[model samples]
Target: MRKEKRSSKVKDALGSLTQDLIDAGLGSPFTEKELNYYGINIPEIKNISPKKIKVIREKAQFSQSVFARLLNVSTASIKQWEQGTRNPNGATKVLLDLLDRYPHILDYRINKSKRKNYI
Candidate 1:
Protein backbone atom coordinates (compact mmCIF):
# COMPACT_ATOMS: atom_id res chain seq x y z
CA MET A 1 0.00 0.00 0.00
CA ARG A 2 1.27 3.43 -0.91
CA LYS A 3 1.59 5.83 2.00
CA GLU A 4 0.36 9.34 1.40
CA LYS A 5 2.83 12.11 2.08
CA ARG A 6 1.84 14.21 5.08
CA SER A 7 2.32 17.96 5.55
CA SER A 8 4.91 19.04 8.09
CA LYS A 9 2.19 20.42 10.36
CA VAL A 10 0.32 17.09 10.33
CA LYS A 11 3.53 15.19 10.91
CA ASP A 12 4.53 17.45 13.79
CA ALA A 13 1.11 17.12 15.42
CA LEU A 14 1.13 13.35 15.12
CA GLY A 15 4.69 13.17 16.37
CA SER A 16 3.85 15.28 19.40
CA LEU A 17 0.80 13.15 20.16
CA THR A 18 2.92 10.03 19.92
CA GLN A 19 5.40 11.48 22.40
CA ASP A 20 2.55 12.45 24.73
CA LEU A 21 1.31 8.85 24.70
CA ILE A 22 4.78 7.60 25.65
CA ASP A 23 5.16 10.29 28.30
CA ALA A 24 1.89 9.16 29.89
CA GLY A 25 3.39 5.67 30.45
CA LEU A 26 1.48 4.29 27.50
CA GLY A 27 4.00 3.23 24.89
CA SER A 28 3.53 4.07 21.27
CA PRO A 29 1.17 1.67 19.53
CA PHE A 30 3.20 1.93 16.33
CA THR A 31 6.87 1.50 15.69
CA GLU A 32 8.77 4.08 13.60
CA LYS A 33 8.38 1.92 10.52
CA GLU A 34 4.68 1.54 11.15
CA LEU A 35 4.37 5.31 11.65
CA ASN A 36 6.06 5.82 8.30
CA TYR A 37 3.43 3.62 6.74
CA TYR A 38 0.98 6.35 7.66
CA GLY A 39 3.40 9.09 6.49
CA ILE A 40 4.53 10.20 9.97
CA ASN A 41 8.12 9.84 8.92
CA ILE A 42 11.15 10.63 11.03
CA PRO A 43 13.27 13.48 9.77
CA GLU A 44 16.34 12.49 7.77
CA ILE A 45 19.81 13.41 9.01
CA LYS A 46 21.64 15.63 6.63
CA ASN A 47 25.28 15.14 5.67
CA ILE A 48 27.72 17.69 7.15
CA SER A 49 30.72 18.84 5.17
CA PRO A 50 34.20 18.77 6.69
CA LYS A 51 34.34 22.55 6.67
CA LYS A 52 30.98 22.70 8.38
CA ILE A 53 32.22 20.29 11.04
CA LYS A 54 35.19 22.53 11.69
CA VAL A 55 32.95 25.56 11.81
CA ILE A 56 30.63 23.90 14.29
CA ARG A 57 33.50 22.87 16.51
CA GLU A 58 35.08 26.31 16.38
CA LYS A 59 31.77 27.94 17.10
CA ALA A 60 31.41 25.72 20.15
CA GLN A 61 34.90 26.87 21.27
CA PHE A 62 36.22 23.34 21.60
CA SER A 63 39.59 22.12 20.46
CA GLN A 64 39.86 18.93 18.43
CA SER A 65 40.97 16.88 21.43
CA VAL A 66 38.20 18.29 23.61
CA PHE A 67 35.60 17.72 20.92
CA ALA A 68 36.81 14.15 20.45
CA ARG A 69 36.57 13.56 24.20
CA LEU A 70 33.07 15.03 24.27
CA LEU A 71 32.03 12.75 21.42
CA ASN A 72 33.69 9.66 22.97
CA VAL A 73 35.78 9.23 19.88
CA SER A 74 39.50 9.16 19.31
CA THR A 75 41.25 12.46 18.61
CA ALA A 76 42.18 10.97 15.26
CA SER A 77 38.53 10.68 14.33
CA ILE A 78 37.94 14.40 14.87
CA LYS A 79 41.02 15.20 12.84
CA GLN A 80 39.80 12.94 10.05
CA TRP A 81 36.36 14.48 10.11
CA GLU A 82 37.79 18.00 9.85
CA GLN A 83 40.16 16.93 7.08
CA GLY A 84 37.44 15.28 5.00
CA THR A 85 39.17 11.93 5.29
CA ARG A 86 36.16 10.27 6.85
CA ASN A 87 32.47 10.89 7.38
CA PRO A 88 30.75 10.54 10.72
CA ASN A 89 27.91 7.99 10.65
CA GLY A 90 25.07 6.79 12.79
CA ALA A 91 24.88 8.45 16.21
CA THR A 92 27.71 10.88 15.59
CA LYS A 93 25.94 12.30 12.54
CA VAL A 94 22.78 12.75 14.59
CA LEU A 95 24.78 14.56 17.28
CA LEU A 96 26.45 16.84 14.76
CA ASP A 97 23.06 17.69 13.33
CA LEU A 98 21.83 18.59 16.80
CA LEU A 99 24.88 20.75 17.41
CA ASP A 100 24.30 22.47 14.10
CA ARG A 101 20.73 23.30 15.03
CA TYR A 102 21.50 24.19 18.65
CA PRO A 103 24.96 25.64 18.89
CA HIS A 104 24.84 25.88 22.66
CA ILE A 105 23.56 22.34 23.24
CA LEU A 106 26.90 21.28 24.71
CA ASP A 107 27.54 24.39 26.74
CA TYR A 108 26.98 22.78 30.12
CA ARG A 109 30.02 22.48 32.31
CA ILE A 110 31.09 19.09 33.62
CA ASN A 111 31.77 18.94 37.36
CA LYS A 112 35.51 18.54 37.75
CA SER A 113 35.06 16.26 40.76
CA LYS A 114 32.94 13.84 38.75
CA ARG A 115 34.69 14.12 35.42
CA LYS A 116 36.86 11.21 34.40
CA ASN A 117 40.36 11.69 33.06
CA TYR A 118 40.38 10.49 29.45
CA ILE A 119 44.10 10.44 28.95
Candidate 2:
Protein backbone atom coordinates (compact mmCIF):
# COMPACT_ATOMS: atom_id res chain seq x y z
CA MET A 1 0.00 0.00 0.00
CA ARG A 2 1.17 3.55 0.67
CA LYS A 3 3.76 2.36 3.18
CA GLU A 4 5.36 0.04 0.67
CA LYS A 5 5.47 2.77 -1.94
CA ARG A 6 7.15 5.18 0.47
CA SER A 7 9.68 2.57 1.50
CA SER A 8 10.50 1.84 -2.14
CA LYS A 9 10.96 5.54 -2.85
CA VAL A 10 13.30 5.94 0.07
CA LYS A 11 15.31 2.94 -1.07
CA ASP A 12 15.55 4.34 -4.55
CA ALA A 13 16.73 7.70 -3.26
CA LEU A 14 19.31 6.08 -1.02
CA GLY A 15 20.51 3.92 -3.87
CA SER A 16 20.93 6.94 -6.10
CA LEU A 17 22.83 8.83 -3.42
CA THR A 18 25.08 5.83 -2.82
CA GLN A 19 25.84 5.62 -6.53
CA ASP A 20 26.70 9.30 -6.60
CA LEU A 21 29.09 8.92 -3.70
CA ILE A 22 30.77 5.98 -5.37
CA ASP A 23 31.00 7.87 -8.61
CA ALA A 24 32.53 10.84 -6.85
CA GLY A 25 34.98 8.72 -4.91
CA LEU A 26 36.02 6.49 -7.81
CA GLY A 27 35.39 8.93 -10.64
CA SER A 28 32.97 8.65 -13.52
CA PRO A 29 33.98 7.72 -17.04
CA PHE A 30 32.68 11.14 -18.00
CA THR A 31 35.88 12.54 -16.54
CA GLU A 32 38.03 10.23 -18.71
CA LYS A 33 40.36 9.90 -15.75
CA GLU A 34 40.77 7.03 -13.36
CA LEU A 35 43.25 6.33 -10.60
CA ASN A 36 43.83 2.63 -10.17
CA TYR A 37 45.54 2.64 -6.80
CA TYR A 38 46.46 -1.00 -7.37
CA GLY A 39 49.14 0.08 -9.84
CA ILE A 40 47.45 -1.36 -12.87
CA ASN A 41 47.53 0.08 -16.39
CA ILE A 42 47.14 3.64 -15.24
CA PRO A 43 46.09 6.35 -17.61
CA GLU A 44 48.91 8.43 -19.01
CA ILE A 45 49.15 11.98 -17.80
CA LYS A 46 49.84 14.73 -20.25
CA ASN A 47 53.23 16.39 -19.94
CA ILE A 48 52.96 19.56 -17.88
CA SER A 49 54.98 22.47 -19.15
CA PRO A 50 56.41 25.15 -16.87
CA LYS A 51 53.84 27.63 -18.13
CA LYS A 52 51.03 25.16 -17.59
CA ILE A 53 52.21 24.53 -14.05
CA LYS A 54 52.24 28.25 -13.35
CA VAL A 55 48.79 28.60 -14.88
CA ILE A 56 47.39 25.80 -12.79
CA ARG A 57 48.72 27.32 -9.58
CA GLU A 58 47.47 30.74 -10.51
CA LYS A 59 44.12 29.36 -11.50
CA ALA A 60 43.79 27.77 -8.10
CA GLN A 61 44.76 31.13 -6.56
CA PHE A 62 47.23 29.49 -4.25
CA SER A 63 50.79 30.50 -3.59
CA GLN A 64 53.50 27.90 -4.17
CA SER A 65 53.72 26.93 -0.50
CA VAL A 66 49.96 26.77 -0.11
CA PHE A 67 49.68 24.76 -3.28
CA ALA A 68 52.36 22.44 -2.04
CA ARG A 69 50.55 22.11 1.25
CA LEU A 70 47.35 21.24 -0.55
CA LEU A 71 49.21 18.73 -2.69
CA ASN A 72 50.99 17.32 0.37
CA VAL A 73 54.26 18.04 -1.43
CA SER A 74 57.17 20.08 -0.23
CA THR A 75 57.57 23.68 -1.37
CA ALA A 76 60.91 22.66 -2.90
CA SER A 77 59.16 20.04 -4.96
CA ILE A 78 56.72 22.62 -6.27
CA LYS A 79 59.62 24.88 -7.17
CA GLN A 80 61.35 22.08 -9.01
CA TRP A 81 58.20 21.11 -10.82
CA GLU A 82 57.66 24.69 -11.93
CA GLN A 83 61.31 25.05 -12.94
CA GLY A 84 61.05 21.93 -15.14
CA THR A 85 63.75 20.15 -13.17
CA ARG A 86 61.25 17.51 -12.07
CA ASN A 87 57.82 16.25 -12.96
CA PRO A 88 54.90 15.09 -10.91
CA ASN A 89 54.47 11.32 -10.98
CA GLY A 90 52.20 8.66 -9.50
CA ALA A 91 49.39 9.95 -7.29
CA THR A 92 50.68 13.48 -7.61
CA LYS A 93 50.23 13.33 -11.35
CA VAL A 94 46.70 12.00 -10.95
CA LEU A 95 45.87 14.71 -8.44
CA LEU A 96 47.31 17.43 -10.68
CA ASP A 97 45.25 16.18 -13.57
CA LEU A 98 42.13 16.22 -11.43
CA LEU A 99 42.83 19.73 -10.22
CA ASP A 100 43.57 20.94 -13.72
CA ARG A 101 40.27 19.60 -14.92
CA TYR A 102 38.23 20.54 -11.83
CA PRO A 103 39.75 23.58 -10.19
CA HIS A 104 36.73 24.59 -8.11
CA ILE A 105 36.79 21.27 -6.24
CA LEU A 106 39.66 22.66 -4.18
CA ASP A 107 37.51 25.49 -2.86
CA TYR A 108 35.73 23.18 -0.45
CA ARG A 109 38.93 21.93 1.09
CA ILE A 110 40.45 25.40 1.31
CA ASN A 111 37.32 26.81 2.91
CA LYS A 112 37.10 23.90 5.32
CA SER A 113 40.70 24.44 6.40
CA LYS A 114 40.09 28.14 6.97
CA ARG A 115 37.02 27.32 9.06
CA LYS A 116 39.03 24.84 11.05
CA ASN A 117 41.69 27.45 11.79
CA TYR A 118 39.11 30.04 12.77
CA ILE A 119 37.51 27.61 15.17
Candidate 3:
Protein backbone atom coordinates (compact mmCIF):
# COMPACT_ATOMS: atom_id res chain seq x y z
CA MET A 1 0.00 0.00 0.00
CA ARG A 2 2.23 2.79 1.30
CA LYS A 3 5.64 3.08 2.87
CA GLU A 4 4.21 3.96 6.22
CA LYS A 5 1.81 1.10 6.00
CA ARG A 6 4.43 -1.51 5.08
CA SER A 7 6.91 -0.07 7.53
CA SER A 8 4.49 -0.26 10.37
CA LYS A 9 3.61 -3.90 9.87
CA VAL A 10 6.20 -5.66 7.73
CA LYS A 11 8.63 -6.02 10.59
CA ASP A 12 6.20 -8.23 12.45
CA ALA A 13 5.28 -10.04 9.27
CA LEU A 14 8.86 -10.56 8.13
CA GLY A 15 9.83 -12.83 11.03
CA SER A 16 7.07 -15.19 10.06
CA LEU A 17 7.85 -14.67 6.41
CA THR A 18 11.48 -15.44 7.07
CA GLN A 19 10.52 -18.63 8.86
CA ASP A 20 8.11 -19.57 6.13
CA LEU A 21 10.69 -18.77 3.53
CA ILE A 22 13.23 -20.82 5.42
CA ASP A 23 10.73 -23.64 5.49
CA ALA A 24 9.58 -23.14 1.91
CA GLY A 25 12.16 -21.16 -0.04
CA LEU A 26 12.49 -17.44 -0.75
CA GLY A 27 8.94 -16.36 0.08
CA SER A 28 7.37 -18.90 -2.22
CA PRO A 29 5.20 -20.78 0.33
CA PHE A 30 4.21 -17.56 2.05
CA THR A 31 1.82 -16.47 -0.67
CA GLU A 32 2.64 -12.84 -0.13
CA LYS A 33 2.10 -10.94 -3.35
CA GLU A 34 4.67 -8.54 -2.05
CA LEU A 35 7.35 -11.16 -2.58
CA ASN A 36 5.98 -12.63 -5.78
CA TYR A 37 2.67 -12.35 -7.54
CA TYR A 38 3.20 -12.85 -11.26
CA GLY A 39 0.84 -10.38 -12.87
CA ILE A 40 0.69 -7.70 -10.23
CA ASN A 41 3.97 -5.99 -9.64
CA ILE A 42 4.01 -4.55 -6.16
CA PRO A 43 5.19 -0.98 -6.65
CA GLU A 44 8.10 -0.38 -4.28
CA ILE A 45 10.45 -3.34 -4.33
CA LYS A 46 9.39 -4.80 -7.65
CA ASN A 47 12.47 -3.24 -9.22
CA ILE A 48 14.97 -4.32 -6.58
CA SER A 49 16.32 -7.42 -8.29
CA PRO A 50 16.18 -10.23 -5.68
CA LYS A 51 19.81 -10.10 -4.60
CA LYS A 52 19.80 -6.59 -5.70
CA ILE A 53 21.55 -6.55 -2.39
CA LYS A 54 24.64 -5.95 -4.47
CA VAL A 55 22.87 -2.96 -5.91
CA ILE A 56 22.14 -1.70 -2.44
CA ARG A 57 25.82 -1.83 -1.51
CA GLU A 58 26.80 -0.27 -4.81
CA LYS A 59 24.25 2.53 -4.63
CA ALA A 60 25.48 3.32 -1.14
CA GLN A 61 29.01 2.94 -2.56
CA PHE A 62 29.92 0.53 0.18
CA SER A 63 32.59 -2.05 -0.32
CA GLN A 64 31.23 -5.39 0.80
CA SER A 65 33.61 -5.51 3.75
CA VAL A 66 32.73 -2.00 4.82
CA PHE A 67 29.03 -2.57 4.59
CA ALA A 68 29.37 -5.85 6.40
CA ARG A 69 31.29 -4.15 9.16
CA LEU A 70 28.58 -1.51 9.29
CA LEU A 71 26.18 -4.32 9.87
CA ASN A 72 28.55 -5.79 12.49
CA VAL A 73 28.93 -8.85 10.34
CA SER A 74 31.77 -10.41 8.37
CA THR A 75 32.71 -9.58 4.79
CA ALA A 76 31.73 -13.06 3.82
CA SER A 77 28.33 -12.31 5.24
CA ILE A 78 27.90 -9.37 2.94
CA LYS A 79 29.12 -11.51 0.09
CA GLN A 80 26.45 -14.03 0.94
CA TRP A 81 23.86 -11.29 0.97
CA GLU A 82 25.05 -10.29 -2.49
CA GLN A 83 25.36 -13.75 -3.93
CA GLY A 84 22.13 -15.11 -2.44
CA THR A 85 23.84 -18.27 -1.30
CA ARG A 86 22.60 -17.81 2.25
CA ASN A 87 19.61 -15.94 3.52
CA PRO A 88 20.11 -13.15 6.05
CA ASN A 89 18.35 -14.54 9.04
CA GLY A 90 16.87 -13.09 12.23
CA ALA A 91 17.55 -9.38 12.64
CA THR A 92 19.71 -9.14 9.58
CA LYS A 93 16.90 -10.14 7.27
CA VAL A 94 14.68 -7.51 8.75
CA LEU A 95 17.32 -4.89 8.10
CA LEU A 96 17.90 -6.12 4.58
CA ASP A 97 14.20 -6.20 3.79
CA LEU A 98 13.92 -2.65 5.06
CA LEU A 99 16.90 -1.74 2.94
CA ASP A 100 15.30 -3.26 -0.12
CA ARG A 101 12.32 -0.97 0.16
CA TYR A 102 14.17 2.17 1.25
CA PRO A 103 17.79 1.76 0.31
CA HIS A 104 19.07 5.05 1.67
CA ILE A 105 17.55 4.60 5.07
CA LEU A 106 19.21 1.30 5.92
CA ASP A 107 21.05 2.75 8.87
CA TYR A 108 17.97 4.17 10.51
CA ARG A 109 16.26 2.73 13.58
CA ILE A 110 13.20 0.51 13.14
CA ASN A 111 12.49 -1.27 16.43
CA LYS A 112 11.79 1.99 18.20
CA SER A 113 9.86 0.21 20.92
CA LYS A 114 12.99 -1.61 21.97
CA ARG A 115 15.66 0.05 24.09
CA LYS A 116 19.44 0.08 23.61
CA ASN A 117 19.96 -0.38 19.90
CA TYR A 118 23.12 -1.51 18.10
CA ILE A 119 24.19 -1.98 14.47
Candidate 4:
Protein backbone atom coordinates (compact mmCIF):
# COMPACT_ATOMS: atom_id res chain seq x y z
CA MET A 1 0.00 0.00 0.00
CA ARG A 2 2.81 2.46 0.94
CA LYS A 3 4.70 1.54 -2.25
CA GLU A 4 1.60 2.31 -4.37
CA LYS A 5 1.17 5.67 -2.70
CA ARG A 6 4.86 6.54 -3.27
CA SER A 7 4.57 5.57 -6.93
CA SER A 8 1.42 7.68 -7.25
CA LYS A 9 3.25 10.66 -5.76
CA VAL A 10 6.14 10.21 -8.19
CA LYS A 11 3.75 9.99 -11.11
CA ASP A 12 1.97 13.13 -9.97
CA ALA A 13 5.26 15.02 -9.72
CA LEU A 14 6.28 13.86 -13.18
CA GLY A 15 2.92 14.84 -14.61
CA SER A 16 3.14 18.29 -13.10
CA LEU A 17 6.70 18.72 -14.40
CA THR A 18 5.63 17.66 -17.90
CA GLN A 19 2.77 20.13 -17.87
CA ASP A 20 5.10 22.91 -16.73
CA LEU A 21 7.50 22.14 -19.57
CA ILE A 22 4.66 22.19 -22.09
CA ASP A 23 3.35 25.50 -20.76
CA ALA A 24 6.75 27.18 -20.89
CA GLY A 25 7.39 25.82 -24.36
CA LEU A 26 4.05 26.99 -25.64
CA GLY A 27 4.60 30.53 -24.34
CA SER A 28 2.36 32.47 -21.99
CA PRO A 29 -0.03 34.97 -23.60
CA PHE A 30 0.06 37.10 -20.47
CA THR A 31 3.85 37.44 -20.71
CA GLU A 32 5.26 40.72 -22.03
CA LYS A 33 7.66 39.59 -24.76
CA GLU A 34 6.72 37.15 -27.50
CA LEU A 35 9.89 35.89 -29.08
CA ASN A 36 11.90 33.26 -27.24
CA TYR A 37 15.51 33.53 -28.37
CA TYR A 38 17.75 30.55 -27.58
CA GLY A 39 15.51 29.98 -24.56
CA ILE A 40 14.59 33.27 -22.85
CA ASN A 41 11.76 35.56 -23.89
CA ILE A 42 13.03 38.59 -25.78
CA PRO A 43 11.35 41.69 -27.09
CA GLU A 44 11.16 42.02 -30.83
CA ILE A 45 13.37 44.61 -32.49
CA LYS A 46 11.93 46.02 -35.66
CA ASN A 47 14.63 48.17 -37.22
CA ILE A 48 18.10 49.57 -36.80
CA SER A 49 19.46 53.02 -37.53
CA PRO A 50 22.39 53.34 -39.93
CA LYS A 51 24.08 55.76 -37.52
CA LYS A 52 23.80 53.39 -34.59
CA ILE A 53 25.30 50.64 -36.71
CA LYS A 54 28.31 52.79 -37.49
CA VAL A 55 28.71 53.88 -33.88
CA ILE A 56 28.52 50.26 -32.69
CA ARG A 57 31.35 49.25 -34.99
CA GLU A 58 33.38 52.26 -33.88
CA LYS A 59 32.77 51.66 -30.18
CA ALA A 60 34.27 48.16 -30.45
CA GLN A 61 37.63 49.92 -30.99
CA PHE A 62 38.30 47.56 -33.86
CA SER A 63 39.20 48.59 -37.36
CA GLN A 64 36.95 47.73 -40.27
CA SER A 65 39.05 44.63 -40.89
CA VAL A 66 38.71 43.37 -37.33
CA PHE A 67 35.07 44.32 -37.15
CA ALA A 68 34.48 42.45 -40.37
CA ARG A 69 36.23 39.48 -38.82
CA LEU A 70 33.76 39.60 -35.95
CA LEU A 71 30.87 39.68 -38.38
CA ASN A 72 32.45 37.00 -40.62
CA VAL A 73 32.02 39.46 -43.48
CA SER A 74 34.50 41.04 -45.82
CA THR A 75 36.23 44.22 -44.77
CA ALA A 76 34.66 45.85 -47.80
CA SER A 77 31.29 44.88 -46.40
CA ILE A 78 31.98 46.52 -43.05
CA LYS A 79 33.18 49.58 -44.93
CA GLN A 80 29.95 49.62 -46.83
CA TRP A 81 27.92 49.18 -43.66
CA GLU A 82 29.76 52.05 -41.95
CA GLN A 83 29.49 54.28 -45.01
CA GLY A 84 25.76 53.58 -45.34
CA THR A 85 26.43 52.33 -48.83
CA ARG A 86 24.96 48.87 -48.22
CA ASN A 87 22.71 47.12 -45.73
CA PRO A 88 23.32 43.78 -44.07
CA ASN A 89 21.18 40.87 -45.18
CA GLY A 90 19.31 38.24 -43.18
CA ALA A 91 21.48 36.71 -40.46
CA THR A 92 24.09 39.44 -40.80
CA LYS A 93 21.41 42.03 -40.28
CA VAL A 94 20.30 40.24 -37.12
CA LEU A 95 23.88 40.07 -35.91
CA LEU A 96 24.56 43.72 -36.70
CA ASP A 97 21.40 44.81 -34.99
CA LEU A 98 22.36 42.81 -31.91
CA LEU A 99 25.84 44.33 -31.90
CA ASP A 100 24.35 47.78 -32.24
CA ARG A 101 22.21 47.26 -29.15
CA TYR A 102 24.78 45.24 -27.18
CA PRO A 103 28.11 46.73 -28.18
CA HIS A 104 29.84 45.14 -25.22
CA ILE A 105 28.92 41.68 -26.50
CA LEU A 106 31.74 42.08 -29.05
CA ASP A 107 34.33 43.91 -26.94
CA TYR A 108 35.88 40.57 -25.96
CA ARG A 109 36.98 39.80 -29.52
CA ILE A 110 38.84 43.08 -30.00
CA ASN A 111 41.27 41.97 -27.33
CA LYS A 112 41.93 38.72 -29.18
CA SER A 113 43.66 40.22 -32.23
CA LYS A 114 45.70 42.79 -30.32
CA ARG A 115 47.65 43.32 -33.50
CA LYS A 116 49.85 46.29 -34.17
CA ASN A 117 48.31 49.47 -35.59
CA TYR A 118 50.11 48.93 -38.87
CA ILE A 119 46.95 49.91 -40.69
- Which candidate gets the maximum lDDT versus the true structure? 1
lDDT of each: 0.82, 0.74, 0.62, 0.68
- lDDT-best of 3 and 4: 4
lDDT of 1: 0.82
lDDT of 3 by residue, 18-50 (tens): 666655745444355644422222334222333
Better of 3 and 4 by TM-score: 4
Lowest-scoring 10 consecutive residues by lDDT in candidate 2? 31-40
How much is the lDDT of residue 96 in candidate 2? 79
| Per-prediction TM-score to the true structure, in the order listed | 0.67, 0.57, 0.43, 0.50
Please give the ranking of all candidate structures by TM-score, highest first, separated by commas. 1, 2, 4, 3
Best by TM-score: 1
In the range 1-119, model 2's lDDT, one tens digit per residue, is: 69999887876665565457665786334222222322123347877887788788888889999899888899999999999999988888778778888876676657564455543
Off by over 4 Å in 3: 1-50, 106-119
List candidate 2 stretches off by more than 4 Å.
Answer: 1-42, 111-119
Error of 4 at 66 (Å): 0.8
Better of 2 and 3 by TM-score: 2
Off by over 4 Å in 1: 1-29, 112-119
